[model samples]
Target: MNDQLLSARDLKVSFDLPGGRQAQAVAGVNLDIAPGEIVALAGESGCGKSTLARTMLALEDATDGSITFGGKSLPKSTKKLRAFRKQVQLVLQDPTGALNPRHTVYDAVAEGLRIHGIEGSNEYDQVISALSQAGLRPPEQYLNRYPYELSGGQRQRVVIAGALALDPQLIIADEPVASLDASVRGEILALFQRLRDDFGLGALVVTHDLGLAWNIADRIAVMYLGRIVEQGPVEQVLLDPQHPYTRALVSVLPDSPVGDPQVLTGEAPDASQIPSGCRFHPRCPLVASGKAAEAGIEEKCRTQDLAVLDADPRNWQSACHYSAQFGRDEVRGTAEPVADSLG
Candidate 1:
């Protein structure tokens, strides 16, 4: 079997705008996830992180791209989408919205099994197993309870149970803990970690929280303007960012040093109005300071869109022409956090 469970290349997702314009939500991107690996795609809101996740899950049609599972290309037909969904599950961001108000927890979880054609006692057994895995103890006590009776955390667990019911190989959780309480967020994150360790399940968690990435993900991919500008092991990307955009992201952390980290000046460029050359050049503090230009790369920064550049020791990659100029990120406080909160 291929080591990679899921792979996507040149992935692009575009939406039709009001004025006959095209809004490319997911620009050219490529990624791979190994079995049992938990990878976090971190980016600011509207950076197309969720869109990319949806495209990977086959929930959204790729405007220009290809997604492969276990080295086989995903099928375009509706019948095959069901088969694909059986192996690849999705956990949406909002539990309240994702769950049905009228249905009990048992009904919510059993729905997937029913759709997939599992019947009778087998469905009951699967739902119980799923709810138990999702941290809802014993399963019987909460089976009949409605969403209104459950806490925010428990409701989210119910959403997770729905995904777990399918016994999927891969789960794409979009903002899994964003709406949960601070205390509950850690529990849910810990659950993700536990699931990865115990079940050997591969997960692609779409989150805006860099802290969450540091807390659990084996690798982190930093996205800017729909492109993965930098990616590698979590420690390398979080502690020693190379791309200017990644540096700015890491420098703002609560524990990072205050040596005037590269504070970006302007808002992220709209997808429809992406800048020429480097998409991030307008907000790139390094380029804004005229350093890259002074170093004789100014013209390229203004006219050439950067591509992913391979770094040493394999896996680690950055997309900036000036990435070679940076060293390890400065972090004076080395106190390890027991848990991190989403911003």
Candidate 2:
């Protein structure tokens, strides 16, 4: 019996373009989430991280590959799908847009119960319990208040309360704190950590912010151009990135000590017309600056395609053709990798 809470194998999601070309939103991804774990899916806007999240939630059908929840394939029937949904919930990026201005706090939280036909005389109690769990103390005081009556953080908590009302096991939160103030972002992230500790909830937090991942996630998967380029323990992948793209991302961190910040030129390539070789080669700083050639893999990087990642999700892995050369310590002329060298 596989004990993983959720697992995706060779997952691929694509959409048709006007010229009959396909835009590969998610191309051959393998990921797994254990019970009570938090995995941050970090990437830029067009890397397809959001599409992958939607596919995991079953909102978007995968063009290929398999996703299993609690050891079972995604439900096929509408009834079964609805039942499946009760176990997993989604938290959108914007709280104001997610909530109905007309609905009171109590009604918003109770909506899920009403939809699932789980409502009864205890519905009010359930709503209160969810609100309390979401950090709205003395939940009754806010029951009748409308969304416009709350602050940004409070509104987000209301959205969270709505999900908690269903007693879900896993949460797929896309940019959960992107729109909040910096002070409030910590509050929300801490709330997520507390929920995991108190209820054994598993979550996949989707964001482009590596700093956010550092704060709340146990593991990090760095995606680029529709595929995960590097993934490992949050500390390892962030502090000692192995792929050129990952290195560039980590370098730009406000406090990163990896030499000078490296800003890659140009935007991410369109998914519809992916590059021939390593999808990131076109904008890869190493390739464009001839460092890859110094190491003698530039031609291979441009002409030969690298295979999709296939290592254990918990292990340190990178999909780049020459990952060993980009480790921060190696680049800085140290004999040991970053973790050991830094220590």
Candidate 3:
């Protein structure tokens, strides 16, 4: 057996607004984090990445489908949920806000252990070990310091230590470095990679920055307006994107340097006003008949929603009317390959 640590199937989270309407924050998203893999969920803000993270951790109720951990379905009971909490931990975007202002760093890191009934010399040793593992050197110096007393990087490290203190099998990091200064972000990214390597931890990292995803993710899942548009090995998806939304996202990536010099255009539809037919057709460059015909793309993009198509079961997959036509810019040896691939 493959022993996947976390799997979310058709996960959807919707909220009822003031009127008799619903806002679908997450819509039918499916993902699996195999043991020790770092799966990044990348997209623009409000694209449902964070919503999906909360749903996976059962922090929010799912409107549809399920989340399974270690082959077992998540239980609905509070007691069972508490047990689930011990196995999954979250590191939020702002470390300063995440920690209690009044508590010492040691108290913050040791809080999880205390709640789980872990105590005494062994737990204290583990607390120090976790802080050290997160690269908070001179662990003793940090133990009594409050959040305001630490630097941004050090405060973030303390939060990471708190998450690690629980001995969690999976960590859900929601833009964990987005709030940090540029100088400090790289170190935090390295810490996450180190944690994954040393502890064999699975991580679900939600971020809008494709460059960061490219740097740290083993595999990438691209989201658009609450649904997964494409997913595959980081290199495969970043180098060769099949979905139009994925292509647009990659076009804007600072490191990609591919696509037309002209800025890609189009706004994501509001969740309440999603369009008919393919939700992306209005913004998809490939949907125009002229482009579609030249690329050998069919009419499916205009009238049908494409199912997730797996070109190679091992890595590549996409939900696009003409995914087969798309090729990596690297493969074509042109930063802006003739829109030929869109067919």
Which candidate would rank higher by lDDT, 2 or 3? 2
The full ranking of all candidates by TM-score, starting with the best, is: 2, 1, 3
Off by over 4 Å in 3: 255-257, 293-299, 308-313, 324-343
- lDDT winner between 1 and 2, please give it: 2
Judged by whole-model lDDT over C-alpha atoms, candidate 2 comes out at 0.88
Best candidate, TM-score: 2
* Tens-digit per-residue lDDT, 1-343, candidate 2: 2788888889999999897899999988988888899999999998999999999999999999999999899988989999888999999999999999999999999999999999999899999999999999999999999999999999999999999999999999999999999989999999999999999999999999988898899999999988998899988777777787887887777666455678999999999988988999999887888878998989889888877786376588888876754554545333223442222
Candidate 1 Cα outliers beyond 4 Å, as residue runs: 257-261, 308-314, 324-343
Higher-TM-score candidate of 1 and 2: 2
TM-score for each model: 0.92, 0.95, 0.90
Residue 295 Cα positional deviation in candidate 1, in Å, after optimal superposition? 1.3
Candidate rank order under lDDT: 2, 1, 3
Q: Pairing residues by index, what is the TM-score of model 1? A: 0.92
